[model samples]
Target: MSRQMEKTPAFLTVVLYVLGFSLLMEWIKPLSQLTETGNFNVFIVFIGMAFFLYAVKAPRWIGIILKGVFILFSIHSLYFGESFFQLTWVIKLCEHVWQNTGLLFSDKLDSLSNEFRSLLFFVLLWLITYLLRYWMLVKRNMLLFFIMTVIYVCILDTFTRYDGSKAIVHSMAIGLILLGILFFQKIKEEGPFLSFPAHWVKWLIPFSIFVSAVLVFGYEMPKSKAILPDPGPFINSILASDRLNGPRGLEGLDMGLRENDTRLGGPFIGDNQVVFEAKVDSDQYWKVETKDTYTGKGWTSEDSKGNSFYTTGEMIWKLEEQGKDTSYGGQKSAFLIYQHPMPYLAYPYGIQSISSGLPNNFVLNDQTEKITPYESDTTHPTIVQYGINYVVPEYQKKELESTTAEGSKNEEDPKYLELPKSLPARVKKLAAQITKGDKNWYDKAVDIESYLQSGQFTYDKKNVAIPGKNQDYVDQFLFITKRGYCDNFSTSMVVLLRAAGVPARWVKGYAPGNYTNSTSDGTRTYQITNNDAHSWPEVWFPKDGWIPFEPTKGFFGQTIVHENVQGSLAEKEQKPLAPIQPKKPLKPQKDLLDNGSNAKIKAPSQSNMQKISSFVKNHKTSMIISVIFFAIVCLFLFLYRKKWMPFILIWLYRKKSGTETFAKAYLLLLKQLDQYGIKRKENQTLREYAVYVDSYFETGTMMMLTKQYEKYLYKGAEDLGDWKEYSELWENLIRKTAG
Candidate 1:
């Protein structure tokens, strides 16, 4: 075979790289919501493609240096901006990195900010483009490229739940087209392999026919329920037994908030895994857990009253004073557990009775009104599949407003009014300030709730920063940030209310999920997912018990039944709080002489170039210094190129330990030779290249290097002693060949 190998045009390589990357981006678009920005991705792809092409032709050392500088600049622009020039920014960046290092494998990943997510996407795209360029241009490994492409496609398919089969088909088509291009390039570069002869075009027709048949057959395949495997007794047995202990609460009679056992943190986005389907009579907040004690950080609940259960044959549990009475407005509903398996049953505000396959040993926490099984029975576990008869309270707002805290003391625990000793005084001050005019506790509560709901604060999910170690969450949220999710708003409102002598406790549960299809029996099913996890404040009234209040904007809490109370309250001569506006300066008095004088006024309008020139003129000295600094830097780089180039290359591309290290060193040597007009042919093996080089230059070093490389690559040798030595040998070869 001829020593010279046919070379693909640089432009053609760039085209293929861009095309492949675009296809891959299309496939991965479904992986994250952040990737939906087509313009951003296109911009990044363009920049990346340009860099890759530039790096391919430029000196390896220069390329590495440029890439480093570019990366630093891009990161600074994206994350720090002008702050990057300040020493404080570096310190803060380090602190942030140190604090969040553990989050890579932690649940806190769910609460990552969109900015951080975007940064992560940027890094991911950078790595992908770098690898593509390396594999296509440097390694020329088509097989590796194919494997990576397939893995990427599989990842997209696995992680993403596409709306329709069309997305899958589209991704598949892209994959096929990309693969075709890859194969075509491979055949052109390395020639046809054994299975496919030089006349591979002859097999194309049959292959196309087979692929079409397979696609048709797959699409036409029956998709009936019968096609699914039956979840027989074995599956049920496994599910019941400890052997198949899936996620806690999935199998049934599990109780207690397993996830919310401690303090709540920053807002988190949740998975769309449907926990249950409930058919309720009214749209209400599904109460799962209630916290009585707020430790400033989070909430904790007191112990249950007692393990009280009826020995009656029927699977029924009843609460005290919560009996079958029309006065309580009793209503029945059923819940079908779709995924989650929790111990506590979800019900409306007042759950009177529960009946289903649930264990009769269900105990009720009177303080929190949360129900939990008395004991765990492995044999007959209580799955979430149960029916509940709950009582919905109907309270007249007028009566609630008039009701004093005299009799409510018996119902309202002192803990509800408890605030952290370190709680900022400004919080209480702000609360008192807001409710200064309100006479009754109900009015005060309404004022506080209204103030929170007013356009004073913003609800932010991803941007909600976690409270510092010693900082109070509510204080920071109210006075400083004024931006947060439900927990922030609700907790702040609760604290403020408590500060204002209004008894309120934090409540945790799920929001009324989206209403799905209705059953044949006229019951509407609501699909409750993990994302429905919510928290609000419950204020205590004399007879109304604990009434839920939604301070979080956009959420509806306990339906405020207004019976002449809302209108009466609105009509009460309560002046609306004037928004704090900036104080304007007093206008200057007009002078009679000025008015009499003919003074012409002209509006100043500057072009873009004029603005630029003005800016430069204002900073002329700084500009001159900057120009001098730039010239100095350019001169320094040119003079010290020999000294710094190799160091930069080694820092950028050196591998610590592996056969790959030697391989990379060899590739660098080849690139150096290419620059010196002694290019290694595409098809030339290491031994052949060594022989050719030794013959051409009368050097024995290439032969020795070739033998070591062969041992490392083919013979599975691990002790490829000190890669620096290989680098030194390559440097020596380049120096000798330069003559």
Candidate 2:
């Protein structure tokens, strides 16, 4: 007789389907590391609800209402700073939708506000959930989703820093189980059998056992080292040359700092190649140029193409004359040794004169503050070395704070305060909030600088986000992705200062390079590498001229302020200031970076263990969630064992035809009956218990099965005629228990 198998319960099937969908959702969680895709938990909550409603057969209108509520709550929580019931977020959302509708009609999709983008994302999630519901319930298949999940994880594992090894394992387990259940369900519905066949379980058991064994072996077995070389370096080498050229081609091939300011915001790798060696009295910021214009994306100067002048003998490159009231205490000289030919000279603040070894005349670009050596008026020269004489000013704090916009040249020029029309309003609002109570421009600038380095922002090099085409760089850095390098910090400070009516310009230069050695005269020679290339903001003060401010965390600039001095004797006794904490070393510890201080240029000497540890730390949240999800899946399987174990037991003893096989299968039957709530009392005899179970199930098959089981136990039977002949009675009782 062909024994029938009971169908898997609808509730169990729904749970499995929901679990499969949940596993696929895990793939999206890693995106938080790369972009401002806030709180992946929101997705999980919504997805779970959607699946639950579908499983319960909830009305379509209820699903629509739930979705609307979720969207509103998401907007209120993520976009607004007030209560959920507040209408401000609703008004803003409506405005964004209307504005974005027009932009969409004009084919300017990238220009949509974040609120509209978030709404679109919510809609996308809704669409995906609907499709998943349709596929798992109506179509009774999830093979396509399974395949897509595997591909998605594999791509992320290969291209991004996301470690998808665990995710791949999860996908395999969930996908196989889901496919197995759906495949069986399809067979139960369409196969020629009038009832569920026990023989199908016979086939299924071996298939499942084989797959589980493969999965266990694959996960637990030792993995062989990859035979292929990593392609990262080869690919990076190809792209490095083009990126080093800067946004504009006019910027010369300087290895350290590029002259490009048109496009900013993205991760960059560090280069340790030494660009120049500077022997200085003390470490100071090596200023290359200052940009005055903010075009929403990057820095530019309105006067970049204005005028040029040629200087021959001792070159004077001062921006403005120092007044008698300004105190210039220390006059220092530094010699620079160039490793390669550079288009411009990098000098310290308060520079008085410059002399180069090259025979080329120096062309001074006033707009860019670039001093380039030329063989003739229009020809280039190879600049090997240069000498600069500068005075490090010790400014009086009282004068600086007291200085107003009365004599400020910056107020007359709008270029220093220029902002793009497309710049987001929130940026200015944030700047105003930061400097609300500050009375003077210097105090406001200081507050803004302090706010950036106040631990709210993170300095990262590898996973920084690049602004989209229509996105404002400063706005993104300030509001969305609050993680970046010196460029992000510096540009934001400049924009904030400008928005607050304090004139500020973006300055790009190298950090006082790493201290290498000291000379006989006590002059320290620092090695400036491509990694030392950095940027900062310079606020224009009437009395102090352009004062540099360090906004980047883990870094401090050499800006010294002195108390007001009345006598000449006290001025003479003002000793030379030592370097303000030497720039951190290029070499890293066992850990690659600590709070990302040396991220400007990191040493490439990370050990294998360090790399593994860093990977674990970066993806710790994902790892924890993966482990919890695995535990939950295991618990679910254990809790529902009765619905699944009968097939395993039947498949196990189907090939055997003896008394021993009969005895073992009969014992399994008793256990299934107890689990199904028809328990066998300790006082009842085997025949009586069987009758009790038969009465509970409203069938006499259990009583007949018990007689065979008792015969197997009492009689010394060498063989049971054919176990298949009596299998129908056992299967009939087991199928009833499954129900």
Candidate 3:
């Protein structure tokens, strides 16, 4: 006797399966909030469709076609913003997929477009749905997937901001029911057939009620705080590679003011805590300190070890020449109130003197130019408030541009020009390309600064990536990710400038913060928050000393860039200070390095045409080969589908013995026969189609198969013992289709 007397679960059990799987899918919704992953609703809909199709026992091919269509529609709606089934976005999607696939292999994950990324997500969902069907329906075992879902939801709840309380509740209620149903089915399959259903039902219902009641009681009970220490931070620390030399400090924390710069390039969350409030004459970047050394990953000060102590009343000049410079415009003072205490005081670039209410001596690191307050007992003092006197210089544009390499050669420091020996050569090559036509160091510096600010890089504090092992931070930011906060832009500019043989240093400080209120003395108070923490590059111009440049996108340095003037002293009075803004912040079509000194904005049509031309030029051979190979594979598959499908069906049903199995196998045979060109007409009955099939094959076996399938289909017959003898007939029919 064959094991063909199969019993499928009732409709209620199938509904339980769908509910359990749908609740499991609820875990995915929170990922959208936690990561860059978006359009989570599409995934939920797909999951529902998958479960619905499986619950109704739809044909496999029908389910596949429906899911594939929905995925295509989703991609069209989400990414393309075009009419459904339009060829335009389809072409665009194909191009994006091709380009991003190449980028993916090259480890440029951040560069992938939303379209291709969503496509990959759809593919993942497809796999997940199939797995769910196999585990829940085929094997009648969803315990592993249920446990995995719980773990996933719990982790997201703990590590991220996702609240999984409702999800857990849903999981528990649905999981218990699902597991109960599968357990019932399992016992039914294994136990003595005559007594199984009535005996199991008596125990199963009460056992389920007991489990659910206990769960409810436990859930409603008052819970105390966890006695165990949270190992989240410890686990995160361990997982985070110890790339930096010093303590991580504020680095990698969801706060501003990172102390250690030994490693950089990872994502960070923004902190809006107010660092300080400054009443200033004008918009100014509050300078904290400067780092000279670039150790591939991040900035470090090679010269901060030695600090010079200064009395509170004395003048501490930030400029090299102090009061003697003709470019020194006028005196300005800023009164700073510190909300967040730090060892160092944030002062302006051309600081003259620091005066405070409390009599505290200050210590200055000459190498980094960082000033810290100290007292009579040789201990550091907390700086609550202080007054800073500084000068805003009116740099002569002609003087700045006239200073050649030959002029500033003697003043150049090797330390400022130092780059890591392991630094990628592409950085230097890129710097050279950006500054190709620029004659003077000032223009070259401006060019490199402008290149960064030219809308190529994005200004993002969150979702910033940390450099992986053997990866250079600047290189990763410039060439790969192209998205970061001030540190990335500043570090990159300094690196590029250094690569181009220009003396530059990375300066960390605060940007000109939001204006809060105005005082009676005409001083504007700016509230500087932790979020206002910023960094930029300061290049050493021999004639003008160190001048700060803003390379970070969306930031405009409020300081002046002196434009070159024509004629002599008589015609050239003092030119008004112009705020340095990025010129032509357009996304260039060519390689970033190819954007030379003449970085003018191109017409959109021209840009698009150029892009097309460039893409064809670069990928012509690969595109041709890929298309041909894809076509060949598709043709091969289509031509031999009828030949291979029967083998697949035979393998699928080889170990199975059931009325449902016979039904499924018959449906598959009908599909195969359709593929085999013996198409069933729409008006024909099953018996008529069977007769036609039998007549075509010159056999009477299909008539017998049809009568048995009809009994299960209409009469709901469970025990179909004739399936044993007819199984050979089914196998013989399948084998005949292969020819």
lDDT digits (tens) for residues 586-687 of candidate 3: 122342223446543333333443455446547868978999999999999888888887888787778787556777778888888887889997458989
Between prediction 1 and prediction 3, which has the larger lDDT? 3
Q: Against the true structure, what is every candidate's RMSD? A: 25.0, 16.2, 22.3
* Each prediction's number of clashing residue pairs: 11, 1, 5
The sequence of per-residue lDDT tens digits that candidate 2 reaches over residues 516-556 is 89978688999998779999998877655778899999999
- Stretches of candidate 1 off by over 4 Å are 1-130, 139-258, 261-274, 292-327, 330-341, 357-360, 363-369, 376-382, 402-436, 448-489, 499-501, 514-533, 552-555, 559-739
Q: Per-residue CA lDDT of candidate 1, range 428-508, in tens?
A: 999989989776677888888899998989987545655554677787888788888788878888898889888888887
Report the error of model 2 at residue 20, Å.
3.3
TM-score per prediction, in order, is 0.51, 0.48, 0.49
Error (Å) of candidate 1 at residue 598 is: 99
Candidate 2, clashing residue pairs? Answer: 5-196
Best-first order by TM-score: 1, 3, 2
Q: What is the lDDT of residue 132 in candidate 2?
A: 72
The number of the candidate with the highest lDDT is 3
